[model samples]
Target: MSLPQPVPPSWKDLGKSSSDLLGKDYHFHGAALEVKTQTPSNVAFKVAGSRDSKTDHIHADIEAKWTNKAHGLTFTQAWTTSNVLRNQIEVENQVAKGLKLDLATTLSPEKGHKTAIINSVYKQSGFHTRASLDVFKGPTFTADTVLGRDGFLIGAEAAYNVTEGNITRYAAALGYNAPEYAVTVHGLNNLKTFTASYYHRVSRDVEAGAKAVYDSKSTHGGVALEVGTKAQLDSSAFVKAKINNSGVVALGYTQTLRPGVKASFGVALDTQKLNDPSPVGPSHKVGVSFVFDS
Candidate 1:
């Protein structure tokens, strides 16, 4: 007998459909640039910078990654302008066929802070699981699992604070995915918030998605709704637009300038506050990002 196939995705990705449509490339408050290059010896380097329009502050980061395909190992080191250094090492399918391990550490010299985390993932036919533990400070532990068969999936996640000896987080999600569409619902933050999301491929060049979130902790127990759509203008270009319950609209346009180079432009407008007088003047924000790879 043949083995069953693994599930489509893990619990953390249950809302990926709405996330991609409503959040992808829609940077409406800052400008950013990124450049990446790889060497022949399996070393890759990346440099990125972003500028906040309101504060006029520029933030930058540099990262280097090395991968060894033979050993199924990868290492990454990164440093940011905030004086924080980070390192991560990953091993895949080494100790076990369907297991992966990751170790990550962060150090902040200016703040005299250090932290570490370890993560493990195991996957098998129709099931997937992940666990992460913080080896520093409160030493929190989190785990999540997903089970799927016939395009339907159910998952749950929880976190425990070892130092405090209490459960800090808990959530559950279920989803159904098909070639043409996907739908997911999640109860998050110990059931304090509930969200539902849907994605549909309307046509060969168009996709639509929507998300609804209800928060029990809100002053009036309100619900927020957002709907978005994406249209592929061509193989190298696409446009997206979305609007939310608060009369805020966002539009994004992305294009591949050339091989290994891409650029995106985004704008946000608040319809209700368009005529309001303020120091910032207009109730709109614009952002752009460029990426280059070699």
Candidate 2:
């Protein structure tokens, strides 16, 4: 069998600024008008530079997505390109009819990064197994299997990161899963960075989680903690919020207005960035989003 092509570089800044977190379920076709203010998100929307964005980076982009479902197979692709604004493209294809497999690819041309991931799942007589391989500038391989009935599951996985025929990082995890809660511990960079996280379903409509991170490396400034919660307002609406010890808070919400139509709002504030107070005030962002499932 032949393997898939390699991926481009992936970065956080390339994915977040003026982001659209819409999932595919309807035929969406609509554009968003960002009402910018003196906010950090607004500043990030400007001209794309090499590994950093230029000031006054505000611009407009037209994003359109199309999805097709048929014969137990589904395919979806979206593109956002512009000479005046930033460019992003996404493509996804999943086959879940008889055989079970999924392939997702994301590329950022301007940022010079791409990623392709292939996932395969198998279930038989209450035993579940999943295998995944990711291709980027480097390859990451992981395989997981669990045994149980109902929602209770226990599993372990081993992962390896390779670069130039050398092992850069090796990691393993032990996890338990239930209907309402999950726990896992992960170590990375040969235990240079360690993390443990727990998540639980507090109620039918509310879920909460917390994470603890420890860095053996001195450059990370030691330990950090994060807590977050997600709430579903109704069939078509939801809200999420999270905060970290660094005095950073992020809030986001989404609501479906009508059939095949959705809208959203988000804001993020960081107190650490507010030191020395520039004319734009503390680094903050306030924006709106829209998605039309036509």
* Highest-lDDT candidate: 1
1-294 per-residue lDDT for model 1 (tens digits):
655766558777886977899999887778999999999999999999999877889999999999999999999999999989999999999999889999999999988999999999998888899999998957999999998888898999999999999999999998998888999999999998999999999999999999999999999767899999999999999999999999999999999999999999998888888886762335778899999999
Clashing pairs in 1: none
Q: What is the Cα-based TM-score of model 2?
A: 0.56
Question: Candidates' TM-scores?
Answer: 0.96, 0.56
- Candidate 1 residue 170 C-alpha distance from true site, Å: 0.7
Candidate 2 lDDT over 153-184, as tens digits, reads 44445555655565544544445555577665
Report, for every candidate in turn, its global Cα lDDT versus the true structure.
0.92, 0.53
Off by over 4 Å in 1: 1-3, 277-282
Evaluated at residue 18, the lDDT of candidate 2 is 13
| Candidate 2 lDDT (Cα, 0 to 1) | 0.53
Best by TM-score: 1
